[model samples]
Each structure stands twice: as structure tokens, then as C-alpha cells.
Target: MARLRVFLHSRLVLSGLLAVTLLAGYLVFRYFYEVAGDFPFSQEMLLVFIGAIATVLITALLLIQQTDLELRKEGQVLLLDRKAQIYNALIDHIGEIVEKGRLDPAALADLRVLNHKLAMVASAEVIDRFSDVLARLDTAGHDVLVDEAERREIMRAVAVLTYWMRRDLLGRIDTEDEEAVLAAIKANNADLE
Candidate 1:
């Protein structure tokens, strides 16, 4: 049933139908010419046949283009959903560290896994921002004391990373926008401290 539906909806099937219709029309015209002998083919009949064929072919092309666009849109939505999941996981990991006041062994491991996933699914800009956050965390080390300034910097990095991921998920990130987001993160952190 699925195969039948696919075949019916295929562009190749439409092309085949157009070819068959043209062939059948040509055969019918020929048969009438042969049977009627001296009867001439009317220009009106020829025009009607051409017009009908044009209409069918144009309709088929439009349907095919529309189907292609719909499939692309569906695929993009799925991709964005996956990216959102990754972003959420990253945020949760960051939240855990912020709440705990130090990165633990388990959190570091989870961050590593999330970082790898981000590399696989995230945009270059997002990955770069995330990498900076990861670098800061690594420098601080597991169970190490983080000064207030260092903690604030880490928070700022995570905030900037979240902003980049959100922009990417919404398909609105620009080249200069990262700096703006980072600056906003810095300003917000200042207000908090």
C-alpha cells in the first residue's frame, strides 16, 4: 500500500502519465484519420489537445515542487528539534555546576559527552562559544576553588553560549551577533554582582 501511494505521488509517474496521454491522443487521432479517409483534422481539436496536455504537465510540475518544499521543511524542523535538545542538555549541565558551586567528576563527564554531541549537531559559532566555556571549566578543574571573578566569567560564558544556541535554533544568528550577546551577558552579570 505504501509503495502504491509513493508510485502514485511520484514525479516520474506524472511524467509517465503525460507520455501515455500524448501517445493515446496521437493514436486516436491517427485512427480517426485512417477510418474517415478524406475527413481533415480540425485545428480546434489540435489546439484543445495541446492545451489539455500543457495543463496536466504544468499541474504535475507544481505538485512535484510543492512536495519537495514540504519535505525540506519537515526535515529542517526535525533538525532544529534535535539542536534544541542538545542546547537544553548543555544548559542543564551548566545549571548543575552553578548550583553546586564546583564542577564534580560526574558533571565533567556529562559535559564531555554533551560537548561531543554539540560538535556533531551544533553550528560552528555555537561550538566555538561552547568551547570557550569548556576551556574555562577545564582550567578551573574539578573540585577546585573558583574565585568570584572566575565564577562570574564562567557564568557569562555559559550565558553567551545559551544565547548563541538559541539564535542558531531560531535561524537568526549573524556574524556580529555573538559579540553583542557576549556583551549583554557581561552587562547582565555586572548587574547581578
Candidate 2:
């Protein structure tokens, strides 16, 4: 299947097909001319030849354009799915830390790995925000203790970062939606500091 797709998309293949088509068209015209011997070529025959060429060209262009569009869409969906999985992993790590009220060594290591993956796929803004939060958490130390307030703050930051990452992955988020997400985050906890 893959090889067939490659062949279908190849410029060499297209050129070859076009050459065959033109050759076949010329052969048909030659056959008619021979059969008509001494009779001049009619305008109808010329029109038929022109029409066949136009049809072939138009069909080829449209097929190529459609195939390109479909391939691009598939690539985008795959990227979004990968980003979502990384975001979910980060969220799960945050949840674990919040529940335990302390960052375990294993959780810290997992968060670091997840953050690295996120960096690969996330937009600049998301990477900056997520990295900032992660840096702060790391500075606080692996066995760092967190009170209720601090834990909630950390959770809120992670939540907001996750939301932004998802919105960015899905495509543009309008100003209104951005404001709403910010408001929701603030409402959940005074601020996502």
C-alpha cells in the first residue's frame, strides 16, 4: 500500500502517465486520418483531441490536490494526539503530587521526562509557562513539603498549562476563549501563581 502511494505521488510516474496519454491520443488521431484518406481533418476531431488532453490534465491536478490535503490532515491529527498524551501525563503527575502533599523522587523524575516530551511538541508559550512552573517546583527540592495552599496553587498552574497546551494543539483559541480559561483558572484558586 505504501509503495503504491509513493508511486501515485511520484512526479516521474505522473510524467510517464501523461506521456502515454498523449501518445495514445496521437495514435487515435493518426488512425482516423488514415481511414479518411484525402479528407481534411475536421474541426470536430481537433476539438475531441483538445478535450481529451484537458480532461486528463484537470483530473490529474485535482487528484493530486485532494491527496495532498488528506495527507496533511492526517499528519495534524497525529501531532495533536501525541501532544494530548504528553499533557495528560503531566496532569496525572500533578494530581499525584497534590494528593501526597509532597513531591516524591519518582514523581519528580516522571515530571521531568514528561516536560521534556512536552517541550518537543508544545508551542513556545506553553513550553515557557510549563517550564517556569516545573523550575519553581524543582527549586523547592524533591522532598519539599507543601501546605494546602501551595498544593492548590501548583495544581492550578498545571491545570492552566494543560488547558493552554490543548487549546494550542487543537488550533487557534479566540481572545474570548482565552479570557474565559484565565477566569476559570483564577476562580478555581485566587491565581495560578
Candidate 3:
């Protein structure tokens, strides 16, 4: 999958570059052949070339925008999967922490397995999101862990993640199941923290 993604992206970039190079060559030929001997600076050719370049630029921008949107959508899907796995792990951990939790020995083993899966997913998601957030923070020249304002900003980042999870997972869950998960999460306050 990763290789395929890279191949597709490289293909798009190669195509775009090829297109712009062709456009540039066309403009150079049209200018020299049509206007070089006849006129010093033909406004008509200039406008035409400008329009062509603008069109190519707009197309490239739109394609890049679409790629960015698709990537964001994929990231959201990955994050949702991670959150679900994490929530399950939290549930199992809570069961272990609680009295009369109803989970059998085999269930405990399953919970440990869930935690492993959760760790993999969560690590990937965190690495991606953290890279993004840190880039933003760095660009803004904001200290990541210094002032109260920065702390609030970080909290907002966390809230956004939770909101995404709520929309993707909790919203789709049946009412009772949703409530149960919320209850479990609430009971295990340390899980989210």
C-alpha cells in the first residue's frame, strides 16, 4: 500500500512537471516564431502565454488540493481505527482495575492482545499528528510546554482528536453500547489523560 501510494504520487508529480515543461516549450516557440522578427514585445502573445501558464498553475493547484484532501481523509480513518483500539484497551484495563468486572481469564488475555493492537495504532496516529502539530507550533513560534496559552492550545489539539473519535466511533455505536463505552471511559479517567 505504501509503495503504491508513493508510485501514484511520483506519477502525479512527473506528469505535472512534464505538462509544465511542454507548456513552457510551446510558449517559447510561439513567441520566437510568431513575434520575434515582426515585433519586439507583442502584448497579444504575452497575454496568451500568461493565460496558458495561469491555466496550468490553476490545474496543478486543484490537483494538489485534492491530494491533500484525500490524505486528510485517510488520516482521519486511521485515527478512528486507532481510537477504537485504544478505547477497547482502556475498557479491558478498567475491567482489571474494577471489582466484579465480569471479564474471565481468557478475556483478560484478549484484552492484553487488544492493548498490543492499540499500541501499534496509537503510535502511528500520534507520530503523524504530533509531527503536524509540532510543525504548526514551530511555525507559530509558540513554546510547546511553557505558557498557559500554549497549554490551552495543546488541550485544544487533544479535544480535536477526541471530537474526531466521538464523531467516527461513538456516533456510529448503538445508543446503549455508546453509553457503556462512555461509562467505561469515564470510570477510567487515567486512560484519556
Candidate number achieving the greatest lDDT relative to the actual structure: 1
Q: Model 2: which ten-residue window has the lowest total lDDT?
A: 134-143
- What's the lDDT for residue 167 in model 1? 78
What is the alpha-carbon lDDT for the whole of candidate 3? 0.55
Model 3 worst lDDT window (10 residues)? 139-148
lDDT of 1 at 75: 82
Best-first order by lDDT: 1, 2, 3
Per-model C-alpha lDDT, please? Answer: 0.79, 0.74, 0.55
Q: What local lDDT does model 1 show for residue 95?
A: 72
C-alpha RMSD between model 2 and the true structure: 4.9
Q: How well does candidate 1 match the true structure in TM-score terms?
A: 0.70
Clashing pairs in 3: none
Q: All candidates' TM-scores?
A: 0.70, 0.72, 0.41
- lDDT tens digits, residue span 64-109, model 2: 7687778878989998899888877877877787778777788788
How far off is model 3, as Cα RMSD? 15.7
Candidate 1, backbone clash total: 0
Candidate with top TM-score is 2
Cα lDDT tens digits for candidate 1, 49-148: 8668868887987887787678778989998899999899898888778667787778888998998989988999899999899888877665465556
Inter-residue clash pairs, candidate 1: none
